[model samples]
Target: MQATEPDYKCGVEVTLEVIGGKWKGVILWHLKRKTLRFSQLRRRLPGVTQKMLTQQLRELERDGMVHREVFPEVPPRVEYSLTKTGWEVVPILELMCQWGTARLQGRQEEKEMAQAS
Candidate 1:
């Protein structure tokens, strides 16, 4: 029997299901610039456990958003990069960064005004 696809309520829900997590978006953002090895990814993403990063990368790969290539060489170098679909998510992440910066600035201004009063 063929497997059924998930029934998403909307496009937003589908996007969230694929990239809604603390680390997934960040991972994609980091990979937007260039391909990175597993150790490089780990170093770039502080506070993420190796196990969790591995799991997240696996999920991204499975979802077709991330591409992982294994090189046949000493120590078996592995690298991760964003697929075309993954690159599409970059603009959304940029918007999120803008919104977050504005929100934080607004809050800081509010705090400064209150303190001055």
Candidate 2:
């Protein structure tokens, strides 16, 4: 028998459920281009704490949105990249980013108008 998926009707809901955290979208955006080490991810996302980044990465891994690779080297390196499922979100994430920027700009304009009133 085939496994059943979650009861999400809309694709947006399902997508949101997978990447619906503060850091997940940013992490996914970075991973869309190329794989990155843990430290690299942290460096790119300056405001994210080490613990939060680790936790978010782990969650994404569990959700099958990201692939984590651990090397058995002397320094022990770990890298994260997007899975095929994760790659599907690239366009959606871009749209979200555009909408977010537009919303922020609109809010600023509204605030400025209010201040001038």
Candidate 3:
């Protein structure tokens, strides 16, 4: 279904507003499985600039979709994990993943058929 408003008239738009951005959904996908230290998340998404990742993470935390924990250690360790809402988003993300996989497979088959013809 198509989202009706930029003001988040429905659940889909609200979801997109919360997770919308180049990196937010990707970050959420990674965190869906486990809590990751900042460095670990950085390593996982090597292409993301540190500044951009920091921005996205801060936004997610503000929206309550992600939890940030700080450890009182000599070096000050920090970790990021999905909150309850974030975990609930997992099924939606999974459905998107499945849809993408199917689309890719269809494209591959179409390409092969075109080449054969």
Q: What Cα-based lDDT does every candidate model obtain?
A: 0.95, 0.94, 0.91
User: 42, model 2: CA deviation in Å?
Assistant: 1.2
Error in Å for residue 6 of model 3:
7.6
User: Which of the predicted structures, 2 or 3, would earn the higher lDDT when compared with the native?
Assistant: 2
TM-score (C-alpha, index-matched) for candidate 1: 0.91
List where candidate 2 sits over 4 angstroms from the true fold: 1-10
Any residue pairs clashing in model 2, and if so which? Answer: none
Taking every candidate in turn, the Cα RMSD to the unseen true structure, in Å, is: 1.6, 3.1, 5.2
lDDT of 3 at 101: 96
Query: Best candidate, TM-score-wise?
Result: 1
lDDT of 1 by residue, 1-117 (tens): 999999888999999988999999999989998999999999999999999999999999999999999999998999999999999899999999899999999999999999999
Q: If the candidates were sorted by their lDDT against the true structure, best first, what order would they fall in?
A: 1, 2, 3
Q: Rank all candidate structures by their TM-score, best first, as comma-separated numbers.
A: 1, 3, 2
Q: Which 10 successive residues of model 1 have the least lDDT summed?
A: 3-12
Write down the TM-score of every candidate: 0.91, 0.82, 0.89
